[model samples]
Target: MTGYRCEEFFGEGRRDAASVMAYETFVLENTDILDYLIKSDLIGETMKELLFVYKTLMKEGMLIHTGFDTDYEEMLYRYRNNEKDRVEFFEEVLDDIRKATGVNVRFCLWLCDSPQECLDSHNADQAKHLKEFEFDMYDTSDIVLADLGKKGKLCGYEKLPEASCSVQMENNL
Candidate 1:
């Protein structure tokens, strides 16, 4: 199994919401020096890494937000009653992501082996850790089972907290 490549939203404050936001604000404040640093060779290694991680997490968070909700049970309920088909759902997600992040990300809806597996991963128990921190949770209509990236090389997936094992078993039964 590919075991789904999952991106942990935060890491010991490295990618936490507050850190990301603060660093972003700092970057915006320092825009005058940003182009100079980039054009010149004065950019330090630490700054380079921070910028890379920030951009990566921001994009990943946006992708996850498009396909998930804060509350697991409510997310599942919406999934059960969703009226749009897969194409419609994914397309809507793609559009929203573009609008939110201003990045043109392409998604592959059938990259995963099964939709249920994707749901299980997205709502896995590990995601519950999110409740321990502070971040805005998206109200999603379905579990997004797609890989996010470029046109031919899509490669990102994520799982949030609070997945219900009983719900999985109940559905299986």
Candidate 2:
């Protein structure tokens, strides 16, 4: 098993948000520099690693952003209700990501999905079901753990005095 990669987003603090925003702007405008950094340890080294290893059973695991209000579930339900609308919506997401990142990544419909859990079973009820992918992560909220960056922590991987379970969960994810 190897460590999974993640890039966190921040909302509140000016410093970390500014830093990340700068990097994002640079990557979006200067693809060459982004390419170079991806090939260099200078930027890559900023990626914080966790102790536990992730063993993705799938060849290429899908990452889902099921944030606030559990919209993913409703989004999937709507998409299934209208497949054509779903295609257009997904194309828009891909285009938005490409516009923002200058990259062409594959489109995997989240479908309230994870790598392991595909919806199956006789009963239609979904109350007691475990989501297929426990390996997914939420896109960071419009909140930044600013205090954690006192020692130059990027994703707040370093220990913080009053840490919550979410902090530990994010690192482990």
Candidate 3:
């Protein structure tokens, strides 16, 4: 009734279906990002710039493939084929997503040697971005560091309580 069973019920083994579900969920959950961009009148410009950066990173093989969605695959393919107009591609996708869904979900991206490093990277990134957006920083670093230090490594779904859907690391790896 939970854990792997829940994952199985979601058809996790079927790449296409899982991907569609993930994308749909992402679109629905992050409507605020779209709304913010629209309100700031930076949606088109941001998308173009982001797409360029994404394509360049992909070309340099910096973007890791996590086997989650088709959009990533398409981006990879375009990068490999050298047919991607980075600016145009990113703008189109961002614009379409924004127009379709108005939410903007927070995303944490990090590159670190260890879990703590990852957390630090995430915090730093969040701080910088939030500041740029003129948003208040909650300073959750100490809490996160304490929790991760106590846990040792990131907690998997199985280790969490039955009623809890949130993801947490169990160890500080």
Candidate 4:
């Protein structure tokens, strides 16, 4: 809502003057549109822009793909063959997504090492439990369990009644 300053979100010394100016101009030109997206909750404050765009395209049925092979890949190949750079091709793609979903996507990408192991763990259930323990509380009394924590024990076992000690008491020396 405030003035468009790229350095506010990004760092001051990250981008050159020319790149910053261009980004600022773009933001200023699309102020109203950005405001609309923000107000509509289409663009969240902390949400990653790439994720938002992907979700929006999937929601709007714009990205028609089979996960293995995609039409978007063919589009990108054609654009690359036509001497179109990545920036231009992606700008067009973003514009198309914006026109379809009314969300203007912008994000700063960073390079990082591959975290395939972590990603695999997140994607699949990699639990390594040799034996799974399951407890059954069927027909259990509710009142007996009320003091379980304080007593530090469950109510399943109780002390048996002591045998009569009359014979032992009579034989006392």
Candidate 5:
């Protein structure tokens, strides 16, 4: 391939200092846009993880749980002990980014508070109605949505359309 294939790295460790400073400034300047890209998954899973680590280690000055695969086992790992996995991944890549450029991107959920909820709604039966909403920044937890009334026991939440949700979340970013 003619490409350098640099996109394959876990932590490319090549974030230009100017780019870092620029990105930090951009994040500070356009916080909403950056968060939108994250919720929409515009940067892809790997870059999403990189940004997640960057956000935790640098910006917020605290770790967050991310980099989760939707597989049942991985979900279990994240669901049961997300802190450990997220933290370990952050720790593993923190120094490299520190030595190189810095962190990237924040978070936003156009249709719901968390990524899992978005996934849940995205995967739900097409018959359900979906809506777009955001949670208070202070509210970062997921709520179990059990079936009730005449619905089945595994009733799911309504979610925004997948491509539309991605676009909305990435509107300005």
Candidate 6:
């Protein structure tokens, strides 16, 4: 998808907490960005990907401090109570996107690892998914980094050590 497409989603006015949570859930569920790597294509399948992205976003300072804990708790309750409707959840997400980004967003699910992998998947699938819809490709890892950097929070990454090693010999000495 084009940057314009992404811009459209973020152009919406301020979104409510429920809307934000729903949007995040939609991104988590529909995008093949994470599932493809974790489940379909036989790549890494750890929450590390999600955590990395979230941490990076937090570090980059692009994350809005919107008191999401209460929202999350409410959502979790609804989910656990079986009161959450999948279709409705997605609709709320779309609404949130419209409000937050001012542009309608769409997703094309694929089974691949990287942007290149997504392209390859699209080609292999005869572009069936792509033909049916227009969606912006989202790389969870990249998104995390970019969001964090966008918020000027990449210093968190900078604070992390390049490598961890122990000087056993020096300790003995």
Error of 6 at 127 (Å): 20
Off by over 4 Å in 2: 1-80, 108-173
lDDT of 5: 0.30
Query: Of the pair 1 and 2, which is ahead by TM-score?
Result: 2
For candidate 6, the lDDT comes to 0.30
- Per-residue lDDT for 47-71 in model 5, tens only? 4564444433444433334653334
**lDDT string, candidate 6, 119-149, tens digits:** 3333334433332322233222121111211
* RMSD of candidate 6 to true structure, Å: 19.8
State each model's C-alpha RMSD to the native.
Answer: 18.3, 20.2, 18.2, 26.8, 19.3, 19.8
- Give per-residue lDDT, candidate 6, residue 159: 20
How far out, in Å, is residue 165 in model 5?
A: 31
Clashing pairs in 4: none
Error of 6 at 158 (Å): 38
Query: Which digits, one per residue and each the tens of the lDDT, describe model 4 over residues 15-111?
Result: 2222322232232322222233333433234333433443344344453343524554444334324433434543543454445456444432111
Local accuracy of candidate 2 as per-residue lDDT tens digits, 62-170: 2243542334434433443554554454344334434444544231111111121212211213323432212323232211212121111222111221212121121
Q: What does candidate 6 score on TM? A: 0.24
Model 6 segments more than 4 A misplaced: 1-74, 80-86, 110-173
lDDT tens readout by residue for model 3, 17-51: 11222232232222322233334443456564554
> Which model scores highest in TM-score?
6
The local distance difference test score of each candidate is: 0.31, 0.26, 0.31, 0.28, 0.30, 0.30
Tens-digit lDDT track of model 1 for 37-136:
2233323455444434434433344224445443432332343344333224334434444454454434221222333444343444655644332222
